[model samples]
Target: MYDIQTIFQTANPILNQMPYPMMILNPEGIVLAWNRQAEKTFGYCAEDVLGKFIPFIEEERTYFYKDLWQKIIHSADPLHLESITISTKKGEIVNTPITLKAFTIDNDRYIFCQFNLGSEEQQDLLSFNEFTSIRDGLESSFMMLSIDQEGLISYANNLFLKYSKWTPKRIIGKTFWQMFPQTPESSVVADAIWKSLQNGRQWKGEAEKITKDGQSYWVDLTAIPIFTSAKKPSNFILLENDITDKKRLQNRLEKIAYIDQETGLMNRYRLEQIVNTMISENHHFTFVYFSIDKFYSLKELYDDQAEQVLIQEFTQRMKMYFQDSSMARVSIDEFVVLTPLGEWFIQGFLTYLEQHPIYINNSTLPLSISGGITKYPDDQISFTHLMKASYAAIQKVQSEGGGSISSLTKADHKALHKKSVIEKRLLVALDKKDLKVLYQPQLDLITGKITTVEALVRWEDEEIGTVSPEVLIPIAEETGLINDIGSFMLEQACLQAAAWHRKGIDLKVSINSSVREFRDKNMVKQVRRILEDTDCPAELIQIEITEKFALEAEAETSIIQQMKQLQNEGIVFALDDFGTGYASFRYMQLLPLSQIKIDQTFISTIQYQPKSQMLIQGMIQFGKSINMSVLAEGVETQEQQDILTEFGCDAIQGYHISRPIEAKEVEKLL
Candidate 1:
């Protein structure tokens, strides 16, 4: 029924496309055909084997051939052998697989023979012993899988089945994602495998996969794509090894980054992360920053061993009281507590803390905290702005004598930054000698003549311009710049006084000195040097100290000694702003004979405040009794001047008499 010409046409094309060698023969055992592939593979050409008995099947296998032909004739299908031995044209033997067929065409029989791929001799490939060793090594060392081009599993090695806990039957034909079901991670792996095959490349990576038991494990995977001679992908050989333990260790290492090792609390780094996350979520929260007052002093008293103990105790206390809040230790004594509580609760919490105390080291230390409270999206929307604003408010509160909490107002923020800028620029301004000195005259009440001039410092910066003496003085004192400024004040006043004396000016010059500068043991020598350098008689230079610093400088024996030494050198003293400070009669009685200046507050209010008038009269009587001069300052009007003159006040200084003048204008007064 089948045509011989049609069968040969179809069969010839198929055989030539195969990578195997084959020959064809008539049923009479005469060679009929030999293809180019068979000739090349067996080291024989088509001319050598075309009409010859098909070599390699061997003439010696005549009996076996007869049996094979008989079987082929009986079976309607092609007869196949999975493995066999065959001789090449050079008489070399090969380990191979073969297929044979017999067909009847025009009442004659023809036979076809073919050999399987990679069927070279056993010696040419791996020897039997080496093949067995390699197979054992692969099974023990790797979890291997064979996936077809469609990402469907065709085979899984014994190790893969062991770790995945999947039977061979359950794993085959399943997509990679179906077996793992941990996508998109598993899907990610499948994409990587397919991409490598698509580009004819290999792929390797560490990935997470789920087992049949639904447990996750990490593995290092390596995929190799198998391709045909035409560069078309066929299957992928994927190898993996368990790396779960290593992954866990890496996770722990990453977790350590967010933890504070000292106190077992979240650190500043983690705090920033959470705050930014909450900002992106549009969550409302209050950032409350608290600092313990004089924490450094406490640390010194407690010693190094107690540092960690105190921090741990502080964190525990915060965790206990603020159970619902997120607290982070940003520094040794600083913490940021984030809460969703109302402003009333925050205010109430601060009040309660003032009443209670934290107990540690067998002593109850008072818990006084200065805090800054800022609301997210209310005070600032960015993490940096919120943090900066909160801390700035706290700094302002602490500088004004702590023990309180406050929210940042726009004005407060501007004032704080202004103060900071002034503080920084003042340092340079001082170095550049950019400050000016002006003299306010002090008039003698009885004589109606100017008796002395008080030197006052003024500063006008090129950039910030015109810093108030009230603001600059405090910053100078806090930063220890007062000593240098005080020294400059002394030298300039002495020089000007000497210049006035040269022009026949008989008035004295008084320079204000800070309590800190007054307490220095070198105060006497510094004044003496200035007077000597200026060639000004010591009697004309009076060092004026306010009543606020009355007892502070006097408390130190060294300062008391220096004052007495300078007083003996004809340098007089003036108790400036007398009524404003808490100086007792004892300070006045024990001090060398000098003068007292009534503060401006009493003079300004004398017309209405009868008590202030009485206080002023009593002060005059007391000064006279002590044989010291009494001076009234800020005599603004005739009535106030008349009252002071009637009270026998010896000296008066006020705007009514003269405004503060520059050194060039001093000649008119002289």
Candidate 2:
């Protein structure tokens, strides 16, 4: 057992040096030691907390201490918890972050909890009194409100009243979530807020809300729960920051990336993206590559300006006919259309084109339109090959005397039927339990040990051998089968991690989720159910979500709430494939992420490219600034690992560590 006198003599210097409060508690939850900072923070001297069970362990919340202690004692790992409740000597409630590490000295159990609450000076710097200063204060646009335990708004800041268009009379009694009309529809968001607040945890996320004018807008919201001295819920402080302008800018960028300025049609790049999506989803559509017949001669007949006008007229005509199709200009006279049309429709389009003529300046221009048509899933299924096949048919039409539509021949149908059958079977593969979950070790750069491994899914058909994830993952996303696959992976990963934990390994397993899973309304409940079914500790599971997951506005609230709930249960998130998409800092500010995995594209060239190294530096710095772990993906060489470590990457995963291995095979490495 630890001798109190000896412990003080040995730890006095270290205890006083800590800037934040540091308290030592025994296994029974009795505080044994308190530093100067602790006194300053809780308004309690060392004598006040020492020999006392942590001041306000509410009877209902007592399990929180038990669970936390059990996790640390069994896992032998230091656990950091945020938004813990505490009561000061003055009988005031405070929500502060605490990190607890279990230790044994001479067979005695103790937990050292470091309270990372900032100094009193810092608190004063942001106190409510100063915030009351209108003109120079946090004046601004952010709405702030305080909600009492009864769910009534007890206080509203100036900005909150201004935005609600209410004089204190109308706003005072309204609940925080009911401030606007849209709040009632977001039940998932409201439940999370109420649960987290009553439990002494903070809830934050971006959700659309209705203003007094009945206009909808997005805001970054945060609500911190405050408790009374008796450990009963008192109220919550909520802050809302308007992010409409940021989203508008992102929407503007989305347009610039996909639309063609000249023709008001989807650009070539966007057209390719659409084609790829269609192929992945196994959607059948007709692809037509056509050009005006003898366009050079036709353009020479008119001046340059007149030629431009004629081209615009032809596009207008095509637009009139292809209402539901995606069309784009490939060249001066070449245009392509991807339509969900059949042969009958194509023939009708051809006939319609023959009956009409391009009229400019009240003069008829006799121009023949020829098209080559190929069907997805029936002809060449690969997007690029489909495009080539359509062009070939177009050439065939021009050779056969123009002014016609030509269909894809045997050249485009090579093995098409077999591939379609295979795609159909692959959808049911997960249900049959034919897919495999493999693990690839990730090394902690600081510790130089394997701490986490990503769970990757693999599939092999009885008739067709191994299927590449690259091929099937996209198909799964498009066909809405990813949710099934994701759930399976999560269950398997948890089961495997649980097995490792049985061996006292404390391994963390990473699972990837598609945007579709986030879109599912029951995602949060689903995740909790899987954890219970597998008996997997939430702390050992990490979910990886990508930036593409943020494209849809409606799904944002669900995703953010689910992530927050799971994270509060001790699950961590990774911004997978970072730097590949929009890479918005908004996600970093709002999402409850633990790490940022630098995309391989940036790390692969870091050894030789100065720009790549600079980008890596910026990412690492950004992660540090936001208190997130920096991990590098696809590190294949010692030199690359060294460079990443030199720049402060916390962990790394790639072939350099080891390719994904089967669960049984992982034992040898362990």
- Candidate 1 runs further than 4 Å off: 1-288, 292-311, 317-370, 373-406, 608-610
State in Å the error of residue 378, model 2: 9.0
Residues 61-170, model 1: lDDT tens digits: 87777677667765655556777676776788877776666655446666766654422222222333464458667667889888887889999998889888889998
How accurate locally, in lDDT, is each candidate? 0.75, 0.76
Compute the lDDT of residue 184 as modeled in candidate 2.
Answer: 48
Q: Give candidate 2's total backbone clashes.
A: 0
lDDT: worst 10-residue window of model 2:
118-127
Give the Å shift of residue 502 in candidate 2: 1.7
Question: Ten-residue segment with the worst summed lDDT in candidate 1?
Answer: 118-127
Cα error, candidate 2, residue 71 (Å): 67
